[model samples]
Target: MISIRKILCPVDLSKGSLLALKFANAISGRYRASLAIIHIMENPHLDIPGGETGAFSFGELVNLYKEERQEEIIDVLKQKGTHAVDYEIIFKEGVPYKEITDTARNIKADMIIMSSSTSEKSEKVAGATTERTVRFAPCPVLSIKTDHDQEKREKIEKIGDLMDMSPNVKRTILLPTDFSEHSELASNYAIAFAKEYKADLIVLHVIETIAEVSFMSSVDLPGYGTTSIYYDGLLKDAQARVKNICDKAIEQGIKAREYIIYGNPRREIIDIADKESVDLIIMGTHGRKGFSRFISGSVTEAIVRNAQCSVLSVKHPEHNFV
Candidate 1:
């Protein structure tokens, strides 16, 4: 069994963070784990001419600000009706990602929970803090998208907040792939996860109709000219690739299935996840090497922000998740 003792959640008090807090609180409650809520107290920006020379810099004011944040978190917990779970809110002054990683390592945390917040410093997809921490953090990170609107949250929340629907339940995991290095890496993790939980694995490959110009170049077809003929070939190719992946999982003693669909990657993925009621979605933040890590418009990023299940987004440069 995977042992989760302590969970560390980093928040910036945004709506995104509030939604993430709901998931963290639910998971902590289900596992009976200790939850530590930490907020990085960034030094306030002073636009004055002698701001740097002042003795009363924002660093000196962190402790006082920390107290205020603590009270704010308590009020949030109350407002959100999350009083059942025991949590301690702490604050630190430093780089957001660095502080979050250090706090997780220092406390020997089993996992880090955070939101994909939009910041001016980082691209809007995975949030700057979340992207950096996922690559370097000592533990696995659970990043929820702020794009989940109220209706979807209510629907999934009623399902017991993603993976914690029931203890040791036979889970269904969705792994969407574009056959990139990181996507392959994510598949390995998904297969292992299925084996660990005796869960069923769903291997999906989306033949994007809209993102076709870029994607179709890579996929080898019969070189057909007509649109229908071209798509038929692409669909056939995707089906084969997806089935082979499912076979790999089945060989590893896991129940597995394959689904190939042609549509918008993000939309199809979410639709299937909701249809199958999958407990988890394992995918990569960056799939193709040609794709920029900072590309906020990637399909994985879209799914991250909209999946009806918990998302485990893997970056290429990452530590092993035990």
Candidate 2:
């Protein structure tokens, strides 16, 4: 039921953003998802303390920049569109990151596809914009570089309307879970993707570390019954989690299977993806911040760096958790 039916591609009219727009167009053409193109002007209200004295009047400045950026964006869109794809462009004033996130939420977009600068100045090719958008987006965000000659790909009005661009889940899909609410959320997406393509769903949950019992039971136990009991609890819980996920898929009448393993989360996630020959990995992030963010979890970052297949990282809306 969770489908990528609507997509948001926020552009700043940079060459990279334009490349992102083309990529979004390809994906939207494949799935028949609506494309909402957004442009956000940087907020002008804030300045360093006592640094605003020489600033121009707000109204005069606003009108001036608006006319300039709006014209440029319109020209870019006109150049980008072909006869087949339908897209809507939105111009708003606010913080780039906030407005992008807000518009995606308002439109209930299933994904956000954007281009990242591969400029040497950027430490990560994914870029800070891509990272921030991924951190906050309610749906999947595919941050791709401007590769693949666009002149070669055909065009379509809708995503599902085009068979060529339809993703091949049959080849592979990498799923990572921490056994959290949002991890289950990623499972929902992965299951649907697998079902659609009739692909093998390699459901994976890593223990992150060997359990204390497993570590202590180095020597053989007195009876196999007690040892079985110890492992049973962990496996039982994992089975139930996997069952709940599979149940959602079964409701859609799709055949789905699962796997559970023990190891470091990031390494296992990448390893299984490589071993299974997956095309994508769908996982979840908690989006923790500040000191807590610094000291603890960053499975998304690790997997993104190490994964061979594409990674789709999902996070709950802020309100969804609270």
Candidate 3:
């Protein structure tokens, strides 16, 4: 069984953040997890003349801002009726991603939930904070999209209706894998979520035809054969692996299915999710950094950016809470 004791959610007070808060609140209630809602105040570069500096010190201005933000957050939580689960509001000043990740580590958070989109006035590029947090967060990160329907947004405005509008994810969950250790970790989360929501699970593996061609062009190595024979063998092997995973899910009382496709893994994953009307996607990230991340370009990040449904990016934690 999986356990989620603590969840951290960062909000910038945008409509996007409101949408994310909705998910965080609902999931926390479902798991009976403690929730910490944080807001990071970016330093405002005040170019005041020396003469007017005495009117209010920078520290005083920050304090004033924090007071206003606290009131706003309290009102938001009240409107959403977040009394079902234990929750706290934290205010900090610094870089958004750094503060969010640090708070999660400090709280030993089991999960981090936040919006994948940024406000128009944000200084950083769109999705930059979310991308950074996903790469560096100690635990799994679930990012919600802000592009919901107008009707949904309207529903959000109605006080005490948040629980009804929150995502239940009771339809289908999509998990894309390459069968690596990272993918194995993600599979664990996929199974846990499927059981929790009583949702069907779909495991998909995509074989890159370009890689197949590369393999075929190699010199006839020992235990190797013609291209057609090699392709058939590869397909059979993938089927067995995918089926094994589905079998495990079935044993856990989950409705599960497997799929094997030939194409780019990233593109195929997103396309299939749309075709199947998947409610969520759970996948693993290598947490690639610096030059390697730039060169290879993370497939998980690409999917998170493009997928219509929410995405949960899991990384192996030092302590396995789930």
Candidate 4:
């Protein structure tokens, strides 16, 4: 079982971030976890009090901003009726991603729930922040895309308006794996969430047949006969592995199903999530960086940016809280 004792939610007081707070509030209430709301001021400039012209010292500015941010958070929580939640407000300066991740590590946060920018243009820039945080975060990062689906956002808003604290609305969760150790780490989270919400689990293994064939053709392979034969063998192995994962979920009293698709992993995963109407997608991130990541973009990041539902990006952590 996974236990979340502390949840860190980083917000910028944007519409999307505040919407994310609703999710944070719901999950914190469900897990009975202490919520820490951290806001990072990238470049803060506060006017002197009483319309004074002199510049305030950095320490003085930080203190002033801290009090202001605290009041804003408190007012937002009070208006949302989430003031009763066990929570604290944290204010920091400097880089947003660095501060957020550092705070999570400092507080030993079990999870980081935040929102991603929804606009196509802004998403590219702001998505980098989310992607970086996911790469360095000590625990799983659950990123909520506020503008992905209108109906879903409306539903979440209604829940907040009604002060409904029941957060386990996830009925179907999609878990895509490539049979790596990172995927195995993500599988643990998928199973735990399935068991927690009593939701059906769909285990997906996507075979990049085109890429495989291209790589095989480029190299001098020995035993491999034709692409068809190689693909069939790979498909059989993937099916078996997926079945094993589903079996484990079933053993834990979860309704589990397995799926094997042959196509672009990113496209297939997104299509399946939309087709299945999945509520959440939990996938593993290899934390790839620099040249390799540039050559082959991350499928997990693509899903996080484009998926119609919420995405939880899991990286193997030094400390196993889940």
Candidate 5:
């Protein structure tokens, strides 16, 4: 089984950060994994007589801050820590995204436990951090948002149980692809996951929005034979994409099924998930910039918001694609 070992929680020292810390503590307790509490200070500078110094120059100052914060974090851990789990605290200075990501990678953390804040102010901060982590982090990230009210905390706990990843429940993985290299990498991960779980693999592709219907027009029906041929070729191309994905899956020794659907990609993907009764959906998000970020690659965001099942979105590293 895939085990979660070290969980990295990036803190901004906000109340929401503490909530995320609590959630991480719970998981670490359950699984007995090491928890790393990381707080990053962004470009902190102090103006001097001559000029401003780089944030990196304040190493001693940052260390002092971390030491103070670390003590407080340890106190929380002591109150909530279980007898079985072990954890440590870390404080670093750098850009929030870069430091957290680097630390996770350097330590080979199995998962990252962070929070998604809901307050208007917190949401703005979280949205950017979440986007960066989701786009670039090597491991899967779990984001939580904290409300300080006791009643709200209970509500959040209930929601967490419903969504809190349980033990070895992963059985089937749905991989929606556009047949790009990024999709292929995601497929590789899905296959690895399926093999680990002895699970079934579902490969899906949608021919929507971009799908064109072509036929010979009566105005030049006979002359447009080539156009008719091209339309047939398009369908063939779509089928080829599905076939290629299936071939890769089979090569990986995974039991594979492929689906090709027409209509809106988002709607079609969700419909397929419901119809197939899948437990999880693993798909590649193109991470197209500008409006696409808000729309989440047009179809991907739609499926995530609408689907009843769990979704894992994998994006190509900019160095690889962009």
Candidate 6:
């Protein structure tokens, strides 16, 4: 059984934090796991009951200093169905990403649920704060978008919510792969998740053709004569790899299929998720800032931002997320 003992949800109590809060609460309710709410204060000083620094500009801290509104934040969660008494409120100081990752590890959290920035400038992603936390978190990261306006939006809802709406329908899950070690690791999580839900899994491999690249912007490319040959060769290789993956799952009698397509990996992944009505997209969190970590294109980031389903980003095995 996939065991989840604790779920850590970091929120600023912003409108963006609600959808993530809903997911966290739903998952905790389903798994009967503990849930904790945390609001990180970037500045350590600023009238922190006793006094430490000049002033904290994070806004929530401002209220904590002047009005003592911590309980008020808890009340908001209470109104939305999560009992305030069921969770402990964590207040920490330092850089947002560092504090978040540190808290997850210190508490042995099974998963970190937070909202990603969906602004136009962000390439529809988790932004710097969410991305860095996912990069260093000790466990799997559930990065959600802060796009809910009225009620829960379908685009941000995943398996936790699905478990509430439909318990008998076989969920379709999409897992995009690049054949990298990180992607391989993600496949393991995907397999485990599929077994948990008894769902059909679709392994998708997208080939970024020269034509698709050119469509995104002005880029010079080789003629179809050369490009088409390279495309065919790449497709064959991807097909062989996907077949192996599907065969293994099918041999075990798990519903599995393979899809190979030539297009922008980012766009294709999102489109396929919507088209298939996927419950979740389990993929590798393989993005790095500049030349720091191994640089994979932000295809994973885009999928987290725009996919019409919740995403589970599995970090490298080197990271401790147990």
Top-lDDT structure, candidate number: 4
Across residues 15-110, which tens digit of lDDT does each residue of candidate 5 receive? 767666776787777667888888875533442222154434565655555666777677666663342277767767667778888888888777
RMSD values for the candidates in order, in angstroms, are 6.4, 6.8, 4.0, 3.4, 7.7, 5.7
Q: Which residue pairs clash in candidate 2? A: 29-159, 30-159, 30-160, 31-159, 31-160, 32-158, 32-159, 32-160
Q: Rank the candidates by lDDT, best first.
A: 4, 3, 1, 6, 5, 2
Could you give the candidate ranking by TM-score, starting with the highest?
4, 3, 6, 2, 1, 5
lDDT agreement with native, every candidate: 0.71, 0.64, 0.78, 0.81, 0.65, 0.71
lDDT of 3 by residue, 129-183 (tens): 8888888889898887665466644553442443343455356899998887878
Write the residue-wise lDDT of candidate 6 on 257-297 in tens digits: 98998787988898888789787898987656776544455
Which residue ranges in model 1 land beyond 4 Å of their true spot? 1-7, 14-19, 25-37, 43-60, 71-90, 94-111, 116-140, 145-171, 195-200, 209-237, 251-255, 274-279, 287-297
After TM-score superposition, what is the CA distance of residue 271 in candidate 6 from its true location, in Å?
A: 1.8
TM-score of each: 0.63, 0.66, 0.85, 0.87, 0.57, 0.75
| Pairs with steric clashes in candidate 1 | none
Q: Compared with the true structure, what per-residue lDDT tens digits does model 4 show for residues 1-322?
A: 8777888999887777887777787777766789999987764454336324447776776677677777777766665444325898887877888999999999988889988775756445556778789878888899987775577778656644433325555488999999999899999999998887778999999988665356345443458766667777898999899999999999999999988988899999999999998988999998888999898888998898888888998888755557
Worst 10 residues of 5 by lDDT: 42-51
Answer with 3 or 5, whichever has the higher lDDT.
Answer: 3
Runs of candidate 5 exceeding 4 Å displacement: 1-4, 13-32, 42-85, 117-119, 140-174, 188-203, 211-259, 263-281, 285-311, 315-322
TM-score of 1: 0.63
Superposed by TM-score, candidate 6 places the C-alpha of residue 43 at a distance from the truth, in angstroms, of 7.5
lDDT of 1 by residue, 1-322 (tens): 3556788888787666766877787767766788899887655434233445765566555545666667767775665433325788877778888899888888887778888755433335337667667656776677765545578557544425354435556678999998878788778888878887678999998887745454445454456665666877788888887888888999989889888887888799999999998878888655333445455356665665556567787656334454
> Against the hidden true structure, what lDDT does model 5 obtain?
0.65
